[model samples]
Target: MTKKQEYTGDYPEKTLYLPGPTEVREDVIEAMAEPMFGHRMDRMTDLYTTIVEDTKDFLDTDQEVIVLTASGTEFWEATTLNLVEDRMLVPTSGAFSERQANVAERLGKTVDRIEYDWGQAVKPDDIRDALEASDEGYDAVGMVMNETSTGVRNPVEEIGDLLGDYPDTYFVVDAISCLGGDYVDIEDHNIDCIFTSTQKAFAMPPGLAVCTVSDDAYEREVEKGDSSWYGGFRRTLDYYDRKGQTHSTPAIPIMLAYRKQMKHMLEEGHDARDERHREMAEYTRDWAREHFDLYPEGGYESQTVTCVENTRGIDVAETVETVSEEYDFVFSSGYGDIGEESFRIGHMGEHTVESVRELTDAIEDVAGL
Candidate 1:
């Protein structure tokens, strides 16, 4: 047979295996394709406002929602700039979780941390003990809701519960990879600040970030002025309050994409989408154990994605390349430091059991073990 002809936007693309930019549903893809409008007009603000409202419900927060044009990293900075003062306590288990310490130091806040083994969830007991043991008494306890680098989902609610005794210490969570993929009840966790990116479970292309800030966190930022200027929470909150818009010109197209994607997630029903993720993860994990072992332990694996340890040691990168050529699906080989001996398989967005089996079959064939 001759090589198949290809044309952009003419044919539907194959599935994605990467952690983000996963397969988007047809309805969502078409939602962004709807008519464009002036960003300065009432239409844009209305769209933006809708997203903020939708995000609040999705995150289960009664907090103020902020949408930015940059990646989730920016929102991470916004949290420190917005409310964090003096010192913060972080429990780092993976690359991204450790990164919060770096950002906090750069933002001129003192940091304390209770370290956990890589690819392991930080236990609620340890967090509670740390909080009890610390004489300095941190103002905030920060953690990643899910650690993508090592395929671990931290117990955010459990950790947040540890902070209840210290009412002044707010709980900050990085829900970058877990926001829409699972349920996050802000009131239950007493989360003062939570941040996330658009590309993961939201099933949209990268470039926009979202966060919900509690009134306590907002007031804290007001008490500590000038932590940051541009893209800072204080100014953005003021802008939103004044005219119900971003402080600067927004990323109109990405916001448009978000509006469409959020609608799709809502239509899919929260319980159903979450159940799909759980079921897909279960299938993928069981299959992976038959051939290759998972990087993280049972009960701690990320539901939206899985990291396969390079136990086969059979040129994981080359196997990915071959599978991509024949199967038209691709995912990265783990994240930093762990990339050499591991690979990730994402099941977020529209990825299903059939898609996972397709990729798994390709892997078993290519690896020949």
Candidate 2:
């Protein structure tokens, strides 16, 4: 029999530079330690409503927001079940976007993909071509705003604008890694549904997913009559309208943390946060260009995470380990097929350009850049 190892809760505190589970603020962490309350209690309602409304304000959107105790992946399934009745269009660029399409397929929906190279962006023209080429109408068109695996930022706004032409086809975007940091005009862009995770640009701990649902998308789910019980827009939003809490029991501690972090987010302001992230991305890309090269195509790079091509052919895994062990700075190697060929640096979530340079400096020291 195999023996299980016990956790001692003693470990080196390394700064996170990975795509997700990014470094959360100390106060946010402390907020999670608040006393627990019953889900039905007024305190729970206060916590839930605060975060939901704050999120709407943070995004500058009038669309209904849903906060659930799940990863951003939950919306991949939820959007599929709610919006896509029989067919959806997904433009595959990187791992995350591909997975979303796969989720729809697994739900027994026919998924048509306009494939792009991992580092290439999803073009709106291609989406238009796909829609025009198809004789049958699609129920939804889904795409990832930022492909974390390859650092490609698809032009979701352009696609959303084009989707406006196809009124019958709803537009759903998985903005899990860039939503809070990137300034997306959700309503102006005609996006039907957009979702994200707290751990990414929100700079909070994992276990909460946030999404904005347009009235059209919500009504479509209602008409479908067969939707995810836990993730249904009708179930969650209607319950919030009546009880001011999640339909299911939520992670109250995380809600506490969310409330705290959201206050910080509001103070920072969405446009300011977007500019900060943009500066970090510019700095990271400059550094990458100097020492290595960027993995993603030019002009479509992600602002939250930067994937550096291993141009100098340094040992990515070894350098990551050495930086963590020696400098207590943790970054990420490339994801999936690009593993070892590239490395990723997460710059979102409370991290400034000065702090990001600290990791790059450590990398240069360890990798002999």
Candidate 3:
């Protein structure tokens, strides 16, 4: 006789208020349930073209768009692999930004960095100083538009304006946490390459990494033969131009979800979406200040996530666990060393100010503050 195993097929439903992999829309999830199709078929081309064109229109940029079945980290390596010829200048302000510099070094590229204290935004003047001081000059400058760890939004536009003088040096931005929600003018800022993950602000399930590549970046890669054969900007863009589909197999199910979600995003329009994120940030910041304090510098807090300082000396992990157990809601503690001293509340994606209030109210109830 076989022994019966105990099983409880039930899982606790949590409304994610964490940084990445935030709450996914029900319809978006269902979209992935769509029937499978052949990747080489015309139908795949239609799906690929629709999402690519829609993303370009949504971002209001004429640059090439590449959607790969990978995380935003893939672009970090791809950009380093393809564009950087000699040395790359990276600004280190937080965990993710520092990791970008580290990735470049691991790829055997010379990495020059302008370091800042964690929670502080990268100073554009400091970047200009680094560029001015570098006698040999750098091939590219990498930065994070939003530092997810400490919840600081760097002045990418100001840094981009500074880069305009150094035309030979390309500018790359990691907009993983901010793209769809923050409303950056990529073309106007002269940003050569910027990438994001769908799980962050696109309000979709994870798997796809979307990137915008400028003509300058493409041309530079073309000059360097055999650069990043797999994820190269020119190769991907060329394949899309020829067949209107990805060079490699893509996550078709996720693309179906992306098609559906991007339609909703385009309908909402960039102005409205950006305004919504701004409102959520303002509301979250106001709430944090009321209960505790913001971890990031003044006037530079992230529009997507708010890292609240433990001014009242509350147990952050315990408070988070209690709130989750009581209310079936979840947010994040700070990243790395600051995890115990600070907590994070994500306000991006499809989250509304009303939804954020629900989590805040639950936290207050649990913390008794």
Best by TM-score: 2
Model 2 over residues 205-245: C-alpha lDDT tens digits?
89999989999999999988999888999999999999999
Local distance difference test, per candidate? 0.81, 0.93, 0.93
State candidate 1's TM-score.
Answer: 0.92
Rank the models by lDDT, top first: 2, 3, 1
lDDT of 1 by residue, 215-324 (tens): 88878777777556766667888888877778777878778778887877777877788888898889988887887888876688888878888877878778888888
RMSD in Å for model 3: 2.9
**Superposed model 3: Cα runs more than 4 Å off:** 1-9
Global lDDT of model 3: 0.93
Candidate 1: which stretches are off by over 4 Å?
Answer: 1-14, 33-36
Q: What ranking of all candidate models by TM-score puts the best one first?
A: 2, 3, 1
Instruction: Write down the lDDT that model 1 would get.
Output: 0.81
Clashes (backbone N, CA, C under 3 Å), per candidate, total 0, 0, 0
Colliding pairs, model 1: none
| TM-score, prediction 2 | 0.99
